[model samples]
Target chain A: MQYIWINGNSDQGVSPDNRALAFGDGLFETMRLSGDCISHDQLHLHRLMDGCRRLNIPFSQATAESDFKLALAVVESSAHKFWRLKYIVSRGATDTGYFCDNTVVPERIMLLEPFTRDVVSLQQHGVSVIPCRWRLSHQPALAGMKHLNRLDQVMARQEWSSSDIFEGLTADSEGNWIEGTMSNLFVVDKTGCVITPRLDNCGVAGVMRHVVMNTLCPKLGLLVEEKNISTFESADEIFLTNSLIGIVPVTRLADKTYKIGQITRGLQRALNTKESGL
Target chain B: MQYIWINGNSDQGVSPDNRALAFGDGLFETMRLSGDCISHDQLHLHRLMDGCRRLNIPFSQATAESDFKLALAVVESSAHKFWRLKYIVSRGATDTGYFCDNTVVPERIMLLEPFTRDVVSLQQHGVSVIPCRWRLSHQPALAGMKHLNRLDQVMARQEWSSSDIFEGLTADSEGNWIEGTMSNLFVVDKTGCVITPRLDNCGVAGVMRHVVMNTLCPKLGLLVEEKNISTFESADEIFLTNSLIGIVPVTRLADKTYKIGQITRGLQRALNTKESGL
Candidate 1:
């Protein structure tokens, strides 16, 4: 009845020598488990595999599938019924510095926790965000991969703590819009075109961001483009997306206000239909 | 009796919920131990304290002094002599996301290992290095701190594994020189002005680099400059520095060759006089 599982066992704690703890040599996926379904699991697995390939951690597709199944079984057996699952893959434990040894086995740790985000309230009456002074660093090698080197996001989150502020939008060093501290952002221009910042330089390519860009927007016939977005002042509408909160529109950013436009409502409906409780 | 200590105790392993494993919300200092001495103790402590302030992790001066004293005591009690000690300060363990809670108690894990390096041969013959395809990311927020988000360094280390190659030179995305994979880089030009890449934008500010810049070069009355160094073709000498390796000169880089210059030899002598078996 344990909610934590490390390498398919619930008894083992994390090793002090784990490369994740040592050098952040790992990847992680935060997925929403609603009822019995994990939302957009294929996309999560795809990104995880891509991260593994980039870091050379040797996480095979078969191993990911097997681990996912184990995670599913553990979630189903939970007595308290968990909602959020953080699946992590570390480059195991090693005393070596900066060297990714080929002989090292990857360690997977899955933790399920009870989560209750008031999605309906937030979606209906959007969320207020602030502009963070903290900017993201551009590393094309590690960009867009949801790896564990997230000190940037951690720093960005410290920018705002007001109860009214739902998130803080962080930009790159050049002032180009990157993403929210915990979610992906979308900007709708006056031409009714949806735009998200290009993640080739920084920011995570979130699972739900992929869903909106590839599925919901296409289903609604709305044109979405990915580019370097700098100003949000002229944006007709704005919204944030992540696995936990499917699509929460932004109503206020600093002093500027944005209407929860037609596109946002449309995407919200589409996401609701796709992910029931999300 | 133990070579490892986590918060003054040796029995506890790292918690699975550690933010270091979760988001790399941590800082670490690797210091060299010879007999009863830890090399450049004040510099390492200063860096660690500065890192805590930057990350907003509440660590008191009294606590750091206490932990350091405890670390020294553990080393003295060890039957197996330890040469290398890695002092880690994680943002502790939490199930929460990006927003760092201020009340969180930072976890300190100190690991001591028996490390051996043939310093004389490498310092005399010098080591060969190659230019890395992997580049460092520019983050003003994290520049110069020896934090745990070292995936850039981890990836850079994998670029060359030829036993003959000791390190790789990693530049920033704009092709400006940053640092070596594991050590700081210094290039002595034709006019005898020693230049090292500025770490204001990126790269770890190593303790040895600080010692060389602030102490050794001044002692020799040598002209040392910190700026953007792109080409090494016109360099008279080159060297690498870290807590573990101290000052090891570079004899070969890619196709070009360099001699172990008089400055390197002088600095080596100064360092030896200062730190006896370091």
Candidate 2:
């Protein structure tokens, strides 16, 4: 990392009693930083605040904005040309238990790392994905919030070590295709209609996924559907999205091969235009 | 907290990049330390290793044992009469991402706290509990491992703040009674049979639960049954167990009141004998 900050102070370490480490009691946001600008800063902050509310962690938008500004200044002072900013809000340190004192100030850890566009080629030619044998447990109580209880994702990511596999597509225990390891999945049918997995049960409601459904797709005159998608057999195209790697098309999954369809390309171009403007 | 140790060294902090803070990628054991000995040290270590295997965190028994020994020594030299030893093993610090390098040696944080025995009176007269509205998500992949993704428990614990309620009983998403916010639940039938919720879907397979099922129950001539226990209507007695609080009888839940039954008392006596010998 080029820069690190804790609760807006320059620090690289956290107390062992931090609730984030104790009980995965926190939320985090990872955003793509181009120069001094963060992509979809408002949306990221909105989601973080939403998570804090649901998890009952105290969050102040003003304080977070100030911290972001300080982190950006630190990044600017560094020699890194491109950056990936990670903002973590944990329930701070406590007196050695799960019962938290809500009055304690929340701890914020901000990290800025030199960006490496590992998926640049994958975005262009599309990437390979595999069906992860591990199924995500369905828990609506914690669904759709980007809290730190991500053992499910960590286990899914460990299913494969091959560099060739860009991501692993995981299903819920009930056999519904939920999402990719680190991104949201969108599939296009032959009729040009878009469908993404409904995340009411389990899955991160990614910021990029929100952008595609609410902004880009509507602008392009496409209707985005959210449902329990079981099979990719009916899909004409498939892609993944995250804040850092806006959109990545999946070219192959096991024996099935997919090509970059027109809708995928059009969405990609639109997203590029929007990102470039940012 | 009286003392803290990280990787066998006296330390109070961890890197912000530590996977435990970032993703809650860790497992922890809260063990009761009586005098110079940690109660059920073997069972605690066994469960920790099992958690490591299930979560794919690299674990060395010798390293963990040595760390535990050093931490115990620190506690022994301290002035505290009673102690609680918390052993945590995280996937160490990594490049900012969920994708881990399995070769990285896991980080160990051992915390020593002066035990307050906050529930001593409750253990005698029995404590009141209420059913939590927040349901535990069912993820078979992460069901039994006492890994650090305990946001479910934290949220459940936060549901009630009444000092009269000592614990909250949480159910799985499907309405099956699973466990307490911090302990495992057991129900005894009038026929002298003991039933604990089947943890195939969700709930921490606590070390104390293991000891009760494997070692103590059979010795007391109790046939322990693990099944989907949906209702406590058939229960003649109710109790909870954890490493710190061995076995806590439940006197009341909502309007339903229960007295300390014969089987519950028998098991409690057996546990007391075992603990006293330790």
Q: What is the DockQ of each candidate?
A: 0.78, 0.85
- Over 4 Å off, model 2: A77-79, A118-120, B118-120
Could you tell me how far off, in angstroms, the CA of residue A244 lies in candidate 2 after the best superposition? 0.6
| TM-score, model 1 to reference | 0.96
Question: What global local distance difference test value does model 2 have?
Answer: 0.87
lDDT of 1 by residue, A1-278 (tens): 23787887775578778888898989999988765667788999999999999899897778767767766776676654437888999988877587766898999888877766677789899999999999998888788999999999998888877789999999998899889988999999999899999998899999999999999999999999999888876699999999988899899999988889998999999888876665
TM per candidate: 0.96, 0.97
User: Which pairs in model 2 have colliding backbones?
Assistant: none
Residue B132's C-alpha lDDT in candidate 1? Answer: 94
Could you say which candidate leads in DockQ? 2
lDDT of 1 at A64: 67
Lowest summed lDDT window (length 10), candidate 2 chain A: A73-82
